[model samples]
Target chain A: MRYSGFQVIKEALTGHKGWKPVWRDPEPQSHYDIIIIGGGGHGLATAYYLAKEFGEKKIAVLEKGWIGGGNVGRNTTIIRSNYLLDGNEPFYEMSLKLWEGLEQDFNYNAMVSQRGILNLIHSDAQRDAFTRRGNAMMLNGADAEMLSTEQILDRYPFLNVNDARFPIKGGLAQHRGGTVRHDAVAWGYARGADMRGVDIIQNCEVTGFRLENGKCLGVETSRGFIGANKVGCAVAGSSSRLMSKADMQLPMESHVLQAFVSEGLKPVIPGVITFGAGHFYCSQSDKGGLVFGGDLDGYNSYAQRGNMPVVEDVCESGMALMPMLGRARLLRMWGGIMDMSMDGSPIIDKTHIDGLYFNGGWCYGGFKATPASGFCFAHLLSRDAPHPNATEFRFDRFSRGLMIDEKGMGNQPNLH
Target chain B: MIINHPLLGPRDAAEFTYLGDASLINRPDWQSETAAQDFYEYGYLRSNPAGIHRELWFHEAGDRSWLVVTRNTVTHEISNVEMARDVARTQGRSK
Candidate 1:
């Protein structure tokens, strides 16, 4: 049913008996035309677009665990398009546009709140950098505004403006960027894809690939061997592990990134605030809890939990940004395994193996790039060519020396 | 996570910078015939094991020494630590 105020009121009056499960829990079929591994936000959205836009048939999404059990449900849930690089700016801007119309398109309440995102400046050099970044964003058809220190203070008065080490200078605000209810995004995409006759099989893990002479035919799964004509893998942090089954190595490292939420308080933060000097970014949830995160735990591990030092480091950065944050008690903390690439960007390209496509290395940007990643991935899978916006995210970019090093931090996955 | 430094005593792993696979220190000769392929393998191909692993960590906050830390990836337990310079010397490298 198409959800609306009328539907809510009608359901409330009629005991809500007509409400249905968001998506059907179906068993995996023997064969599929297109099989997508990892039923996270990107996978589900990819299946949704493949059927909706590309008119592909017999699509199946196989999730090792429950839908949204991965990073889709375990992220800080911020979204933005304030990118500077030519290869990245257009792609992220496309994602922001998709996020803007996502709820209406999918007929779900994702709560895509465009409350805006502010990146604080702590020095003259940062202001200059953000100035260039804002102009680049605007040139890419995305909204950006350079806010003065007084304007930033006016918007977020709780922030500490007078600090000896890292003084507050100014900010770059993207008024179109904001947060969404992370879980609902998964549910919405799953429902949309299922409605189009795509099967979403949960509790189904891919064990290996079914290959013949360097061409992938299907996958061997926990349930059994599920046959497919083509397979697309979007298993984020598990990219290397899964691809290794095919004896392929990726230029990505897996690291754990932790996020924290504070105890609920009165609404104070108007929107998202990112400290420029450090690696902390925060946004106050609708429930009045401040949700934030920082750098990844610097190691290669598949573990979802992180160590204490990174936690302390994150809290220290948050405290540095806003000393008032000290009063807010941390309620909960969790970690997501990030597929950090060599150049600190993502990779979405066909691998050396035929009929096998890969989409990963998203690192911290995976959550925000859900819609566009799925859309462009679907474009690539359907057309067997790079999308107009994602030409730089190729497998050979490293060898070709066309790395999309956004942070200019060369080759270090942890620093990115 | 704490790494018991060979010289500086027990230190928090946070202060140390992590790099994957201490085997990276063994740089293949660039003048060799298979240098291109060797460098490709050296630069990109590295094993990511789930159990015990020997990796590199720089004591950036301490004495600026590179360390070879042998730790379990699954349990986060450190079993051994040695100065990477010493380890490099054993591997027949200088300067």
Candidate 2:
């Protein structure tokens, strides 16, 4: 798990290595000016940005578990901004930009390798859709390349190469898109923020909140009560539960997403690849293991355990796409709860409550959006207004039919 | 054969369904059964179950958590077609 810079970069190129935490707080703090109720990537990123942007110290990130213990630590770390939806496109593009400059910005090695992500096209319809998406990326100054079947095979000789069921007609490759160390992102932001006087309270769960005159005064945690001028709930899985205490209902649902890793072998996959026809996606880890994941567990459950059907489905897709992986033994599998929004996008907006802010509903692709989401959420929290790109991601959009329904899958809780 | 259930579409139309303990719909009446037989003889149910078989389905249970259905075409044999809830419940148990 612990990777050096060279190993991290190399593993990132192959989609193989993950970040091992290098720092931990020796003592936990009791209070802060701002109490963020999750230690995932978003919470840590928000803390880092809050300290960096507002110079507001005494910020405490209270987590029921360790840093990166939530979806931040358990995600397919493929980073890209190839969004076609209006509201999400620009915001994700900003995240991609931050990914490009992350190492220099944080002075921490995130191992953000721009190895390119290829969204394979299975048919002419898919190709046309990808064309529109590629054009949009180009218009937004993001790098994208449309490739033919020959080009795909030439670049990736290890693929099955041909199959009538799901032919590899072509694909859209974002040259600037790739994978990163998911845990390192959380730690990097946490370390950077901690150095700026933010208190990261691990193993400290926020049990409830204290509201005074329609405003969030502070929170009551397992450790004790802590007062804060502003409180942001960045807890991805527990967003609705926390918000419900304030008589607010988020257009959010908590669903489980599962990921798996195959036993280590010599690296074969060179970049992150997604099968548009199937739910499977994969990138080789730094240690030569195949790291991959599939769609969310179709049913609702707070339990972080996934069933065999999805594992079988994803593995079958992987085997069909890469026949060589048939012999690769799956070493382990894990699941994390995701706050899937109705629109499959995040909600970075202030609630009707005066001091209560929210940054959640990341669905499954939150790892890549961490930096930008935090930056935008921090801006909103500080200014009490929406960020430029996130203006349409308001909490009230659902009521006004302004939902950003990406993937053309309406704002259904189970669709994402 | 395409077995058409009331709640669910044709059998093939269903991605997968759950089999349950009891039926939700009653058997067809005499006239409807005769018509169904005629349709089945004409390759309606023979080719696609959706043409003749009337299946009882319980929506809102299973993997997709929609419904349970039962369909029959020839002898009118009814059987449940839904993901086993116990299996899902067992699978959902935390490790």
TM-score of chain A of each: 0.99, 0.93
- Model 1: CA > 4 A from native: none
User: Which candidate ranks first by TM-score, i.e. highest?
Assistant: 1
Q: Which stretches of candidate 2 lie over 4 Å from their true place?
A: A1-31, B1-95
Model 1 chain B poorest ten-residue lDDT run:
B41-50
Q: Write the per-residue lDDT of candidate 2 for residues B1-95, one digit (tens) a residue.
A: 23343444455322443221122122234477475544322211111121123232334232244343343322324454543343334545212
After TM-score superposition, the amount by which residue B21's alpha carbon in candidate 2 deviates from its true location, in angstroms, is 22
lDDT of 1 by residue, A1-416 (tens): 67899999999999999899878888788999999999999999999999999999999999999988999999999999998899999999999999999999999999999999999998888999999999999999999999988998888988888988998988999999999999999999999999999999999999999989988989999999999988999999888888999998888878889999999999999889999998999999998999999998889877888988889989999998889999999999998888888888888899888999999999888999999999999999999998899999988887767889889987778888
Per-residue error at A108 for model 2, in Å? 1.4
- CA shift of A81, model 2, Å: 0.6
Clashing pairs for predicted structure model 1, backbone only: none
Could you tell me every candidate's TM-score relative to the true structure? 0.97, 0.79
Worst 10 residues of 2 chain A by lDDT: A17-26
- The DockQ scores of all candidates, in the order shown, are 0.53, 0.03
Candidate with top DockQ is: 1
lDDT of each: 0.91, 0.75
What is model 2's interface RMSD?
Answer: 18.9
